[model samples]
Target: MIDRRHFLQSAAALGAAAFVPLALAQPYPSRPVRIIVPASPGTAVDITTRFVAEALSRSLKTPVVVDNRAGAGGLIGTDAVAKVAGDGYTLLFAGVPHLTTRWFTDNPVTFDPVKDFVPIARVSSSALGIVVKAESPHKTLGDLIAAMKRKPGEITFSSGGAGSTSHLCSVMLNDLTRTRARHIPYKGNGPAVTDVIAGQVDFTCQGAPSVVPMIKAGKLRGLAVTSAGRWGEIPDVPTTAQAGVADYLVASWIGALAPVSTPAPVVERLSEELVRIAQSPEFKAFCASQSMYVDIADRRQFLGQLPKEDAHWKRIAQLSKES
Candidate 1:
């Protein structure tokens, strides 16, 4: 029933609509894509970034490389990538602190955590554990809390660095228990944890992936986990809330992000690939080996949670000062 001219016009519109997705996928990354890991080369972020990059490289049919830029508690690397061309080829392997750390600092950073970037996907999240040297006097988390309560502001703890997630964890612990603890900032968790093992600092919080082995070996004593529920990775470990401090939980998650101006279709494609990457059996095993859990969500959910994280940043910053 359609005339030739009308059929041609309809076909033209349908073809144009189809061309958008086609163009979006048009052999993207005709060259190498750089995934920026904004931390030391051997840290959890670095290790997982490498794994995801390898899987993504094979899936995307492009050689995706990881660039480790470490400094200023990950700010240096974030800033570096923020200025790169908005093409999909350049992306950041960002940690959760991308939202939290800024409020704690007085210094003005050049990077806009939200506006300057687009979230591709939330790859994974892990809990932190408060640990001390195996030979310490604080036999239990309750004892540590009692000691702090009795001498408010006297107990001391160490963190990976100023404004690091470890530091925020210490701040959160102080707020929850209504105690005061002195903070000692170090270069990274490895160094701060070294001091804990050496009894240089009283205690500190570290990610489960790195601390579980030490706890198992009896080198470190885990007092409380920073997640809401107990993790099977350390069956004997209790969550901070379960350890008598109500409503205590902190997590560190890594995600892929691109410049905000990148086209939505491009970002959607990237997110789909990320979800696939997370769903792969190999990636699941990889996460289990590290005791990491995927927080995998599409863009809308990620964007919705950004505001909640922003509010949490303010609370932690205020608590850091109070502690």
Candidate 2:
């Protein structure tokens, strides 16, 4: 029913309407982006998150700053990010602790870790090592395990806190070996390692970087690392499998995440930039220097793997409760 002129006008209007959304939409990362690190400064999470932020600042063409929100085992900052707008302005630099936080805390978590955040990219990870005081009578992992088997709950282990990766490492070890060890939760990794050095506890499954120096200084002895293979820094140390228990690998990983329901376009942009940063040579060099590795997972893989990891931790929590 339309005339030629009317038809032409309608076509032009349709073209303009299609262009409007694209023109009005602000380009992603128009402003500074904040990375919320839910741990104290100088912690592994904080250090790696800062590296990722610096690299993102370069690639995103905007200032990417790290905001350390240390409390509740990284729950405070992580919860803040979860509750914020999903505009990609705020993000969380999450670690393994983020997964087990709910299990550790007495208060209900304010946000669902899996459902409340969009996985962006994995940053870096380190291997945990079993370390005892240099003067401990046990010389090898087998000797320690034999003693644990003989004593069962008598062999005590310290961790950064309950439900930390360090604690979980010992749990996984115990689970594999079918042995029980007493858990002594400390305020932080530093104190836990300090106590171990003083022989206040038996041993600790702590990150290599935290205990490597002590190992080098003859303060602590490295028995086994929790990686599939020997870590570069301590090549002399055997892996958990090589040490005794086979098929045991528990890596301490950190990654990036944004609030759930973030725009797909923004999430894509952030994920792309972060993956690039994680894979860059500069970052790899930094990780190597720190005895870490660039373990990257893209958005799809990260999200897909979350459910499995969540379930795994949940089972561990349930088992811990049962025992």
Candidate 3:
């Protein structure tokens, strides 16, 4: 009895209406997610990322894997994440180097560190330790500073490499104290700390995880930690300020980030899971064992700190150029 054209239109409308709910009900992360650690395996960043990935996999009910992309000071892995789709399937396990690598490298960076990424959550942060061989004559941080002043360019310091957190922390120390110590860049923190222990270099600033065990084992002496408060694991070591250096605080942090094009809902979901993982007792204990502390920040809070972090790194870069 009805017109044929009108009947066909009604049927099409009914079919379209039925499909919308099914599409909307589809869950995010239907497949495995991979977190790319822009550093070699066994590094602190890689270890932390792996821990987070495991927890995330359990929380999201999907596989979460860590892929190490170590090269060119983390530029390779970072750039790879920047170029990937924003479907939350791929993410970056990033740190301060994410912001400072471009400043230190002469090579052209393909992605904008600030503009190309979105902060999901901040996992943890730790202060670096200024260490020397246990048998070194520089007994304290002040003593080391005095020695640098006394010899100027003669006191050599080693670092993981140019633009590393260790390098930047030492650079900041030199700039703040107005001392000139020759920098010996190594291929990695292991070699740099090794040379310190070998007495080939005067001293080096390194993250706690890399140097704490050495300090405890009498292989290295902790002069000062670059934090406002003393690290719990090594309470005997004073902070930089307490050690008589002011305005010389530097802490390295690791966090999760995705491409800027990622949808807001996906970002929110990931952020929630990360924040939860970061706050759990198990995660806190794990961080403490590594001489790091849980520093959980949500999406908005994490994004808010990037500007200041970027500016701080920029200033460090300028100081490096001047020196």
Candidate 4:
């Protein structure tokens, strides 16, 4: 038989352990939570993250604030969040560039992305669009490639920012088509798009979230989707691969992550709310209106995808280093 003192001590410890989660669950949001967005105000990732923060605030009856820390190709902001304490109060709402099918050694990394954070939810995905001036000479992907072949580096392309989805996708486009298009990295997609419209840059590839409306208004001409398949919003447009640049596919995605070592229960609770918000009809309508798609990946699935993305970027970075 166990001694009375030992038995009592054991019982007390178990009781306290059980009560920790209960006490934490009692009141989740006693104050406002901060969400760190790794981009500027107008990009698709920032827009989507703001929407999620709104929904999260309403659902949790708490204040969810978005803090934009845009610079150094998203690395500056990402590192900020990674260094935060493992408290549920700080979250990083980021895109594919920060964490995706890429590797650090092959690409560029300011931090050890794989170890710094834990995945919570994969909230959404946005396809890229091939955009050119409304009065451009190239009417299709083939036309652009043919022209590029005629004069390497003569064709200039703009991107949202250096090392962004726009930049990576454009480089991938060149890699696939065996042509060269000089890169013009702007501070944000808006400026780049403006320059393209003014005929300063030859073309740009960015997420549909920003270009769809421009394409609709005839301010910009959309040539092809930078996705594997066609876009539902712009059915008439063909994929870059389908249009001639075979194997051309690129997209932007957003996810929510908390610091590693945060209590599993807290992470799971937040994740549950994310899933609920994602499935809401209002959220779906908002995404559709923006020409984006909602893709649900639970914690397990989301975490599993991180390494694959890291590897992909690592290879890209390495190649970039070589060239």
Candidate 5:
């Protein structure tokens, strides 16, 4: 009984209603994004994340910010991101420490390290160097190993903390080389490396970026690099394999992650942008200035390798306890 005009108008209204959802569903990054660094500002993790955040802002045409949530050895900040909505707004700028945190902590962590997050991309990694005081008699890695063997648990090695990358590096070396060296835990990398320079500690397995300057200044001796290849900055120093400890390589790396259940499309977009940023010349230059190297991997590569790294660190942690 309705007139043609009235019937046509009602049909048009239903059509508009059907189109509303499609129009309202905007693409990702409709607003600002935040990359959370679970470490203090000025630390390596913070610096790396800030660089990526700036790059992402340019690529995504959105305002990307870095949020420093430093506390409780990065647990507080990491947990914050882990528990947030899977909306692609919050991300974690994490490195080796993040993977090792739960293994070392006594309290139960709130999220599953392997299941609670989606890998975006691996940013970069800094190689660990085997270093000793310039005046130390142990001139080579072999000499240091021999000393540790001769006096098991007598020679001391310093690390940033109990479960830091430095600590696990030393522990892994001990396990593979079948030597025993006492571990001395310090508050941070700066203090631990400082004591090594002061000859307070026998040696330390620390990141090359932090120790390269000391080596250049003749304050510390670079024996070997714990990387597959010789570090470019210290090309003369042999790799762990070349120095006789076969199959030894370790790097402190940073990667980006979104909360699990974040849409696959969102994850893909983030991964694409991150891969671009990591491969950019600007990022390489920044890494060189910081004594680090650029090692980028896409989402699939990162996700595939994460489980192996987790197992590797777990074994290192167990070795630490035995040592």
Candidate 6:
């Protein structure tokens, strides 16, 4: 006694209903998110990322964790993130090294830093401080330069690694002043700074967050900061320009990135959350405490600057080779 037409319509309606749940499935980040730090735990990038992750966890209302994959000067962790699915679940807490690593290395790099990743946000930037042991005879940046000139390769400087920003800073210093200094590479900036403290190395150029507290505690003497203006935390420290190195300006920036295949909506959401966090007063204060300043740049802005950064570092690498 079934009506044929009505029965057919009912079946069709049921078939369509079955797909509704699938279409209405959860949005991006329904599960925990992991941010990979491509350096040791105590590095400046790691410290800044922990702060961002905590704020992001609250903003997204999801658990955000930091995974350190330190080795090969940040290549391991960065390449790992580049290969993952772009589902918004995995991200990279990236820095200057992210752009400069490939240029500095002789081995084949698996991922293209610019093409393989999408920018999320840029959180903070800090000047590098040229520091030495408090007891060292070189009291100022000029003194250090003079010593390097006097002894050429005899005076030694330590860095996080050969291709690291710290190393590039020292290289730039030597090139600018027409001087020479022995280069010592360490696994991480913490150890490099420690060696300078232990008197094993003559000096080191490190980010403010890593060395500012030590400078305050009198463990390290900050000869000059590699910025146009002096760092607020170490107000007395002169800028490189003021210290007679007129063109030796450098700044280290930290930001977030995801695999390029990530959906536009997901990338937008992450960028919005990060921008919000960076603009918050609490975050600003936190960055200031570490001698960094909150530099909020969302996805578009961050992407726009990548090419310029790449060019700058490429030039730096050439300078290193020439020297």
- Per-residue lDDT tens digits for candidate 6, residues 147-212, read 998898999999988779998999889988999888898888989999999999999999986899
The residue ranges of model 5 lying beyond 4 angstroms of the native Cα positions read 1-24
User: What is the TM-score of each predicted model, taking all chains together?
Assistant: 0.89, 0.90, 0.92, 0.86, 0.88, 0.92
After superposing candidate 1 on the true structure, give the runs of residues whose Cα lies further than 4 Å from its correct spot.
1-26, 104-107
**CA lDDT for candidate 6:** 0.91
In model 2, which regions exceed 4 Å deviation? 1-24
Q: What clash pairs does model 3 have? A: none
Candidate 4 to truth, TM: 0.86
For model 5, give the 10-residue run with minimal summed lDDT. Answer: 69-78
- Output the worst ten-in-a-row residue range by lDDT, candidate 6: 21-30
Residue 49: error of model 6 in Å?
A: 1.2
Candidate 2 lDDT over 130-179, as tens digits, reads 99999999889998999999998999999888778888888888888898
| Candidate 3 segments exceeding 4 Å error | 1-25
* Cα lDDT tens digits for candidate 3, 1-323: 99999999999999999999988668998899999999878778988999999999999999998999988889989999999999899999988989988887878899998889999999999889999999999999999999989998899999887888988898898898889898898877888999999999999999887899899999999999998888888899999999999878888999999999999999999999999999999999999888887998999999999989999999997887777
Candidate 4 colliding pairs, count? 20
Segments of candidate 4 deviating more than 4 angstroms: 1-26, 100-110, 321-323
Error of 6 at 279 (Å): 0.4
Candidate 4 global lDDT: 0.81
Where is model 3 poorest over a 10-residue stretch in terms of lDDT?
Answer: 314-323
Per-residue lDDT of candidate 1, residues 1-323 (tens digit): 77999999999999999999988676666788899888887677888899999988998889999999887787878888889878888899977667766665566798889878888888788888999899999988999999888877677899877888889988888887788889998877888888889998889998876688888899999998988777677778888877888888888888888888777877888888888998888888887877777778777777777667768776787778765
lDDT tens digits by residue: candidate 5, 1-323: 77999999999999999999987588788999999898767667788899889889998899999999976567778899998998999999988878786776777899877789899999899889999999999999999999999999999999877778888999988998999999998866888999999989999998865788889888999999988877777788899999999989888988998899888889899999999888889999998887678988888999998899898888888878877
Worst 10 residues of 1 by lDDT: 99-108
Ordered list by lDDT, greatest first: 3, 6, 5, 2, 1, 4
Q: Give the RMSD in angstroms, all C-alphas superposed, for model 4.
A: 5.2
